[model samples]
Target chain A: MNLYANDMLGEPIGLLLSLLIGAAFGFWLERAGFGSSRKLTAIFYLRDFAVLKVMFSAMVTAALGLQLLAVTGRIDLAALYVPESIVWPQLVGGLLFGVGFVAGGWCPGTAAVGLASGKLDALVFLIGAGAGSLAFAPLQPRLADFLHAGACSVGSLPGQLGISGPVGALALAAIALAAFVGATAVERIMAKRIAR
Target chain B: MQRPYWNPYVAGIGLGLTLLLSYVVLGTGLGASGGITRIAATAAHAVAPAAIEENAYLGGYFAEGRPLAYYLVTMLAGVLLGGFGSAFAAKRVAIGVERGPSAPASLRLLFALVGGGLAGLGARFALGCTSGQALSGGAMLQTGSFVFTGACFAAAFAFAPLVRKEWR
Candidate 1:
């Protein structure tokens, strides 16, 4: 399959398709109630689990779909762009991003949704985020070495585990199912406590 | 009043399909932070074209031509339009600051700004945010994505209490 790999669609047309893809992304986010800061932050309060549920589901679905396509030879998995797994910076970055998530009530993507939904705070958050990125520019050189620490030789989880892609995807799906059940239980328990 | 939101699982499937479409058509996953960073770089470039272009981090964005011409920026514009359409259809499009009852609007906005800054900085460190790293790369079962996901949630849960008043 040509699969539009390596910019086969070209820049102008590719960008048009990108716009449609982003529209779909934002559409689902809003439908999932991510446009609301309270709804997003509710996970931190143990008041809701939409974030986890939605995220895990989406991840599992894509993983499984990719595996299936690869197995069927419908697409070449190697053609996809997979970011490297660098441990230290990603771990530290995740920690900081998490705090920001609960505090700001949005990530980069959902913040755009929030802003579109007319949340004034989302606008301020975006500006601050932009400034934050710019702030990191000058420091990039100093942190370059530390940021690249623990770069995994094998990038994908399947490769790291020495398992086939389908197996790895299945494992992830199972984990997601278990987490969904646990998330529901937690939400139920939280609801009961609030009721009292 | 706005209608209720879609079920998480259902919406997630929709999102996943969209991601799959992106991968198939573009051979790349979705992203948001890259666009945000590029926009910042472009704005800074206008004021200090030499300085911005010379900076190690921001300079790379200008290497391929105008930074604003990147696909991520166009996708971001699409996100805004799509979000607006969805919210409008659901009657959820209203101008306001979202916050807890006890929190003042200014305080809420302040927190938003600070929190956004932190998230943005963190995204750059991790090389992506929730969309780019946790979701897009995550779907590909990248080890760093899982690490980032675990650490992000753990840190958020640990720190949520400190800002309890913001959302509680």
Candidate 2:
């Protein structure tokens, strides 16, 4: 049994580990210039693609690495907790989140980084987010059923497609590669247009 | 004098490795909204313990006594410290609002607040945010995460023009 699966690590130790990992995550985010709302919102304006590049590359890397570990019997993929699928709520949430991202210029994670960088807007965003989350408690009663709509037993792409995890990971990596190439081309064209 | 940001691919790899480390060590993934929501719940509980306890959503977090004792809260503290350390070292810290030249400071702040509220609400509905659901679950090849991600980008692209003034 692994640390989380068997509760091998006590809660205190687990929490400590999370802190270290979170530090690393924040370090990379700041290094990527995600601490700047300008840099982040540029993706929406089509002036920059760093957000997509960083996110997709990270996704591909983690996916490939996890799949490799699972194949080698180093980690139990089945024992790991995966987020559940709630199709309609997630879809609607995604749309609202997108609009908010463009309007606010930062997501919850990035806003924290932005706040650290001393952006007052980020602070306001955090307060707003907190209030919004609190608001959910009241709305939860009305939206419980809808929020859990389209809940499915098979959650993963590989599970849904009946493909192996490694195969699915490989496909995702290939797609990320293509997107990187296409993103570069688009940035070039958009830059030229702006220059002209 | 601001230092140039790291190459996106390099940073991405670092982030991916960090995420992989989380899974290997903790059997879970990175998240931010959880921390935020927990803070909110804790605050609410302080003022209205009974009300929060009676609420279905807020009560779930309080069931554990201290809502801020969760992993996400600790991680969030790390995020703040790490972010501050990186920015301080790089001299990227500045006290001001960020907005396009064409946009007024007041307008930008308003947008930030409104947009943040929408995002927070959406994250609650979706059960996660970009980091937790999209990136982590996407790496796990979760079907709904991919769908949520696709919908986010599609909607962002579709609605970006409406908010073009804020960013441009």
Candidate 3:
């Protein structure tokens, strides 16, 4: 059975693996409280740290994991897709997305999970996101230009910052560990205020 | 146990492994908005199949038949189901609007709809949202992803208080 190596249709074994991975991926997202819109959006209110906690934790974990695997010669790192740097559009879009996130109480991903968790507002959010996409169809040309602006897809942190990926990953991990500590402190302060 | 959310660090490790599994098996990272775009394609086709035939963005997604039938849609279905499955397992599922006690329910819904609309539109414009850009791309060390994460938090913090009336 030919595995999904770079593009063409993956073999049946590869396909099944995809589903399994997806199931686990989905399961973990749910277990993290990401399926709840309230929990997911709590970061906006500084009421909960799950979004930042889970997200950064996940990022560091994956970065380190992939780095290790690549270093060990287990997986072909070149085959994986690294998102290109389109600074301006993503920056602006992220800002808009963040506002939408706080306003709607869900991100596109969590919104789906929220719907599954029986939140009607999640369904509304999903429809709203879909409509939002349709709304932008009229502005295609402008969006396209902005999307591909400064399209640099080069890989590795060392090249970008003159440091190895491992070094970068370690730095990120340290930051995450610090954040975890800080978040607990914030939660305690919040709990005290609430208790008072 | 109680409330059933795995430890954030533990769950995050699990999620990272899931992403790594996807990469090893499927050769691509995780994504969410891509699934919604597929749904949009199916809808656009239903209204007028030919109109999409000439469009650039929508056209590429249209396959020989059944553009919506694919990996992203299936994975997304799993996301929803998995969420419900976890909520049920944790006994967290409930019916009611979640909002600050002082706010009117109608106002919350209004803002929710508008906020969701903007998020949807922004995802399309930027070609991603938090999942695709912040989480997935962050894992990959993408500069844009990091930038997006920074922008998102800054914007939300700046705007959250301005609209504090809805929640407070």
Model 1 per-residue lDDT tens digits across residues A52-114? 999999998998898898899898888887678998999999998999888888899999999
- What is candidate 1's lDDT per residue for B1-168, written digit by digit as tens? 999999999999999989888887788888999989999889888899999989987888888776877788988989999999999999999999999988889889999999999999999989899998999899999999999999999999999999889888
Which one wins on lDDT? 1
**Candidate 2 lDDT by residue in tens digits, A85-155:** 88999999889888888888889998999999999999999888888888888998898789889997988
B24-138: candidate 2 lDDT, tens digit per residue = 9888888998899999788878898999999987887777686777888888888888888899999999999999989999999999999899889888888889989999999
Deviating ranges (above 4 Å) for candidate 1: A1-4, A8-10
Q: Give residue B34's lDDT in candidate 2 (0 to 100).
A: 84
Question: What's the TM-score of each model vs. the native?
Answer: 0.98, 0.97, 0.92
Off by over 4 Å in 2: A7-10
Per-model CA lDDT versus the true structure = 0.90, 0.89, 0.75
- Weakest 10 consecutive residues of candidate 1 chain A by summed lDDT: A1-10
DockQ of 1: 0.80
Question: Model 3 RMSD to the real structure?
Answer: 2.4
lDDT at B69, model 1:
72
